[model samples]
Target chain A: MTLLIQVQLPDGGWAYILSIIFVSLQVSVTAVGVSTLVSLPVALLVGFTDFPGKRVVTAVINTGMGFPSVVVGLVVLILLSNSGPLGGFDLAFTPQAMMISQFILATPVITSVSLSAVESVEQSVRDAAFAMGGTDADVGLVVIKEARYGIVTAILAGFGRAISEVGSILIVGGNIVFSDGQSYTRTLTTAITVEARQGRYEIGLVLGAILLLLVLGVNGLGSWLRSKGRGERSA
Target chain B: MTLSAATVSVSYGPDTVLNDVSLGVEAGEVVTVVGPSGTGKTTLLRLLGMFRRPDDGTITWNDTDVWGLSETERLAVRRRISMVFQEPSLFNAPVAQNVTYGQRVREPWRERIRKSIRNLVGDRTLSESARDALDTVGLLDKADQNALSLSGGEAQRVAFARALAVDPEIVLLDEPSSNLDPRNTAVLEDAIRRARERGVGVVVATHDMNQAERISDRVGFIYDGKLVETGPPSQIFDTPNDSRTKQFVDGELMYDVEETTNGQARKSTSVSP
Candidate 1:
């Protein structure tokens, strides 16, 4: 306990804490940003348009929401492996790989929820917009604007899932980090696991505390953004 | 400036809502369609506005068959003929935006938007043509307010303002004053009078016989999805020739009267004048 306290008193422990928070936030933000960018148009299309195989596409997307993160990690790994096609670019076992895996895991969540949000906008509003000589693009913009608050909530929920997820990032990132002598990368979850196996309970507890605080902070900001968006819309 | 519908019939499945309804409106005319509920009064206005397709009819505007046109051409025709719904149907936007909806202004007209407002509403510092339209409807004070905040009558007036802002050649009103108080109804009637004076053809659908008689130069009576009679208001109201028209205007069932009085029912039909 005394050694753990002494370790935390130094700048090294503080650096580790900050680095973990930064990596977690970077991974989460990138995952959510990419998912949001990719999912919005898909959500709008599913919500608005009618065509053949629409039900099949919707069913696939709904099925994707419950897809296991480990499976996503494995799929990405197989594609980015050295023996796989186009694997010569070598993005495996890197932060970028983790980002891609997290994005795949988060996308369906955002898409499904956003589709519901966009669908909830009244059809009367769409009719009114079209009657005013607005084109399809104009109607889409108006519907998205009216559904902005709900879409934001969907995105925030995606972020929450991305940050809290560990399985995909662990497999894809390999979360290695170096200290004292060598270079490596290590995520909060992986580091805690390694420390616990080494009987470094204090270090694992500290990391756990930091992870809890990070999740709380994310949830807090998400709620704040949702409320702010709601207020702006109502006003 | 001239709107004409010939043999217009609208059907949904086996149920026909309007059948062989022919009407014409020239510039400076206020034509009102008076009927009981579900008698195709509103459906006739929608058909004229090109919002609904007739199963068997042609709508011609100024001698041009509008129904035969392509969708784009139909939209152009629709732009020329604006509609005011029974309810307000305003957007969740400011009043100004609602009025200028679907209207395009040239560069010169864009600059004149402010000036046009002043010209339309003399001595008032009008913001835009929308404000002037609201002024025309006597709701200028509510121009900046959210459209959703309006009372039912005020919202309907806003809808009128929106229709007026487009400077349409023909205006189709479906029960415009049906949801308003008498004062608001008078305001709407006056607006209709002004619209007619400006040579804008007006076709209003109403269930109120007195209101229709007050504003309409000509009135068409629709009964059971068919046009029963149409003529000058004096002819339709004071000198109706059809037994069904008399029974409707007098608010009684001719069948019941016939059954009750047998031979005496024929006298009551002539007595409805």
Candidate 2:
């Protein structure tokens, strides 16, 4: 005779899941926010000016958009490891390390998309701004305003990328859960991986569904904003 | 005040778009440059508007050489001059916002920041000049509507309002009514007259001889990258000095030259069908 048994969540149970969700949200939002602050100005500079090696810089950004997350994970792991160059701060296997990893993954995605959006604004628009006696800085503001929708879409895309990613964050975060079964750094994506590997298919499916809903909502909002941008431009 | 282009020239690679062009518009005067297409009228207007530095010679605001000024000074000078392109190129915003754009740019940064804070708290944002300019174009009712939602005529009027809202001393118009219907054209001409009456100098570039006759205190005929002649409209239309001006006035000259290879404009005569 054989018996089938269901394994319950360890110690903190539903509270554990909530903690994991909170960690995931905290890491992803911080990463995306920091990346945007760096990426937008870089995008604007690259979008508006003609400089030496611009094509090479643009090519690098495009290549970065498709960079493998696992490779990023490995590189970040080495940098944060105890024996590595940046080992003094002891960031290894911590949420800060995970944020650094996700920021690396999100910056190029935001920059490349935003650069395209800024460049797509019409030359006439810039000319009109200049004709109004706007300085270069003022013209930059006008272009930013004009590209606001596409920039928002780019941010959402970056958020989607940072949130759904499992490899980089997992490698850096170590998917830690404490002795009390309270999550220290485990996220939905990393948790799902461990659950599936441990034969907890039901738990894995729940995490997967939640991740899918988050990504779907983000992408849907992006598409809606993109369409609205097109409509406004055409009008 | 006077805005003048003196012996100005512009070249694009091998092509000479405008050569040895000299024109000036005094306050409260209307000067129209008339020519067939591709004859450098737009290029001359661009130079007068200080949009581009002339390849040779000078643009002057009163006694001051415009191109010789520092960038900040040049921008200050530019704030007092406005140009309307052939296409309206209205922003993707409300009509009132478009009209007030020039004023907003001309404002000091501190004031702009103050207004932004007030705007965040829901204070009124439209300036009196913006409303008055919109009223000038008979589009005050459309102030809240998206600029892009307007018809072509209404859009062009809003463009005019935007240019006027800055209280510019000089206005440069480059074929503004070339794409408009007669009714829209009439409205624009009326606005031009009103601007002149308000003591603003107006420089108009057009290929329409009738429009040149209607709005001009002085008419200039440009051909083959040169100013053929300039005089009162009656003298240009009825008793022109240059044969090219006569041919253009009689509607016989049709310029199809889009490029000037080897620095020579290739003019082609229209064929009778």
Candidate 3:
């Protein structure tokens, strides 16, 4: 009777569940952190400075934002494969490859949105800073300080892009299940793919529920930050 | 020391704003520029405030051409002057930070350390000076509030207080009292008086003849991007030499108001297919 009441969960649930969650968090967070560090200066330079061919640079970045994940996966797989140019160090099918793929996918998402965010500030703010005897550096910092909420939103969007993707990470990570009865190179998104393909309906549902919750949590935090930013002025 | 703009000219793409304009502002004096809307009053103010470089001529403080200095040197010179625009233009921060903005509060690392020592010994002199500026503008009670939440005129007053907190040698105002009520206007004028009393030169651009008449030591009437006439307030108001100035002071100059209903009608009709 005790055996009759038993039910199967995702990899029998909790043991593998926490591991998978940790792997997903580690990869997405690292990708987002690196992406933000690289993209912030790009956003600032594009948003603030005037120079020749700025429109071309903006167009390229804007186009990159809509690049297909499958196409990015194909390109990265070729680059990291044995016959490809960057194969000397043998980085293929490793966590590092997944990180590089996610980083590339996340950067344009953060950069384009952050560029628009910085550009949306009122030009009068710059003039006022100058009038108050602020140097150019002071004015730049003031503008960035004012656009903090939008920059945060850009980060969240990039994280969402990196974490929810399967096409790129699968090609780069190989999604292998090891003989030790544990999944290696398996993230929540890639595990969902494996479970759904194997007709393991319950496991797929559980992993999917967690993924949705993570996305919801990030979006909720973004909205809260934006409202708090608005309240300071409206208060 | 005197701050003067000599033969200053400014243009906006195709249209000229100020042409061959020259003015000298002496310490302890209030020089007001009066003109119709769009005759480049704000442009003249921007040129004086170092917010814009003129198309021609030079601005000199104490007989040194401002643009002749290096960028860092120019910035140092700019720190000694403050400008208040028609808009309140306050940051979203608390009123205190807004007041302390132009005082090198966020100085270089080395300068900040020295400033911290000065603060420790002087017993918060900068904070007290900010409070004194707010008190002069009658916003001392609201010092801790977010500056953006103030009413339009109150925000402008906060801006004035912020300018004063810097202890600048010159104050440039661009129609600061145009949208203000009488009480707030009175408060602003009193603040201007205090700045002048501190031996600070004041340059104001305004359209209200009565306001210009009330506060000015010398009044320059600008017309068609040129200083058509300039004299003492009593002389310009009571005995003007230019017909254009008389027409303007008497409210008879056509095409004077930039946003007149007739202009709007013509604009709309012209845009119709």
What DockQ does each candidate score versus the true complex, computed on alpha carbons?
0.21, 0.51, 0.55
Best by DockQ: 3
Residue range A146-216, candidate 1, lDDT tens digits: 67767887887788778778888888888766564221335667667767887878777887888878777
**Residue-by-residue lDDT tens digits, candidate 3, A40-121:** 8898888888999999999998898888888888899899999999999798887788888999999999999989988987
Per residue, candidate 2 scores C-alpha lDDT tens digits across B1-273 of 989989988888777778899999999999999887777887787777766788998999997899889998999899999988887988887788789889888888999888778866867557888888898889999887778889999998999999999999999888889789999999999999999999999999888889989999999898878899999999999999988788788878866664321223545535223
Q: Candidate 1 — what's its lDDT?
A: 0.75
Model 2 Cα displacement at B41 (Å)? Answer: 2.4
TM-score of each: 0.74, 0.90, 0.87
Score residue A130 of candidate 2 by CA lDDT.
Answer: 82
Give the Cα lDDT of each candidate: 0.75, 0.86, 0.83
Candidate 3 residues lying further than 4 Å off, grouped into runs, are: A1-15, A50-56, A88-90, A176-184, B104-106, B109-126, B255-273
| Separate clash counts for every candidate | 8, 0, 0
CAPRI-style quality class for the chain A–B interface of candidate 2: medium
All candidates: TM-score of chain A: 0.86, 0.89, 0.90
Ordering by DockQ = 3, 2, 1
Error of 3 at B212 (Å): 1.2
Q: Write down the DockQ of candidate 1.
A: 0.21
lDDT of 1 by residue, B1-273 (tens): 678889988776666777898998888899999876666776777677765567898889888888788876776777777778776777665566667664533124455466557545653343366566777899887766667767888888888888887777788887789799988888888988988888888999887889888999999988766899998888888889987777777776321122110011111222233
lDDT of each residue in A1-235, candidate 2, tens digit only: 9865465764588888888888988999999999999998999899988999999999999899888998998999999899989989899999999999999999999999999989988877877888888888988888888888879988998998899999988888999999988888899999999988988887787778878887787788878877877776566
TM-score (second chain) of model 3: 0.87
Q: Can you tell me which runs of candidate 1 are displaced by over 4 Å?
A: A1-63, A82-103, A176-235, B24-28, B65-72, B103-127, B253-273
